[model samples]
Target: MGTATHDGAESTAGDEELVVSANARFFRALGDPTRIAIIQLLLARPHTVSELINELDVPQSRVSNHLACLRWCRFVETERKGRQVLYSISDPRIRDLLHLATRMAGDNLEHLAASQRTGPDWL
Candidate 1:
């Protein structure tokens, strides 16, 4: 009985560790604006690293770094076609999250603008 209880506790701890690790990786990957942009672009279609560099208009190194982080987080995947590597979002849920975030941002911006126009105390 003691051994069974110990094993169950260990199993629970392992499951919690896995969940926390996954959550940490996801938030860490999303902590960058550039990375978020990359994910958004990839949500549309796969692209080579060079295409990402051009589209995001950022430094090549920065784009590459973000791509690496995203891949580690399991939010994106890579494929090889000839000498070129393509990157794309691995899950459709990421695209949905991006869309939701965009909508929320837009609503927040509009609310801010309205508040400014009416003054903060204007109820």
Candidate 2:
């Protein structure tokens, strides 16, 4: 028993509603381009904050902020190597997930780029 929202998207009822909410939060965490780039880099190999800053060519604060969100969402994990901390994807399945999303987004590039419902501001 789900009800349609104003946007015509079905809102789950009962226990499933909690799951749907969680799924939204998870996707929101990954919705960021910076975060996606960080994940892509980590998929190749772990890197320290400084290294990420250098590679991403973004401000240290920005990279750290995104890393914090990714860490909070359990999308990433960190390990201390002496004085340096290495950040990496927490699970191997993330590679598959990113690959699938890449394909789907590529296939819908035209539609995705034109959609006003989910614009650049959504990020």
Candidate 3:
């Protein structure tokens, strides 16, 4: 029936909108410099909170807070090694995502810098 087809189309459209919104949120999570740095470190290997603090030269609280955010986003996973909690990238594809993003940013650095609509100072 026409009504059934219309309902199905509406449902599909709604699903697509949800997907787009989720994708945007995912990127927003990576928009933070600290979160991005956390991911970059995890890509190499797992690290403990203390190690991250030492490597990043940030306070323990700052490292822990960002680690929590990364965990909530499912961007990284954790493991227990004796008394230490080690964090690592949740998926291999994340490495590819970071690599591609880096290349894209490099290619568009000029445009991104010139854009007044959005940038580090936009907010």
Report every candidate's CA lDDT. 0.80, 0.91, 0.83
* Residue 8, model 2, lDDT: 85
Residue-level lDDT for 11 in candidate 3: 45
Best by TM-score: 2
Q: Candidate 2, which segments miss by more than 4 Å at Cα?
A: 1-13, 110-115, 120-123
Question: Against the true structure, what is each candidate's TM-score?
Answer: 0.69, 0.81, 0.79
Residue-level error in angstroms, candidate 3, position 25: 1.0
| Segments of candidate 3 deviating more than 4 angstroms | 1-11, 110-116, 119-123
RMSD of each: 8.3, 5.9, 4.2
Compose the digit string of candidate 1's lDDT tens values, residues 1-123. 212344465345666678699886676668677998898888879999999999999999999888888887888999999999999989889878877767877858666544544432552
lDDT of 1: 0.80
| Candidate 1: worst-modelled 10 consecutive residues by lDDT | 1-10
lDDT of 2 by residue, 53-106 (tens): 999999999999999999999999999999999999999898999888879898
* TM-score sort, best first: 2, 3, 1
Comparing 2 and 3 by lDDT, which wins?
Answer: 2
> Can you write out model 3's per-residue Cα lDDT over 1-123, one digit (the tens) per residue?
212344465345666678799998898888777888888888888999988988899899988888888888899989998998999999889899988887989978778657777655775
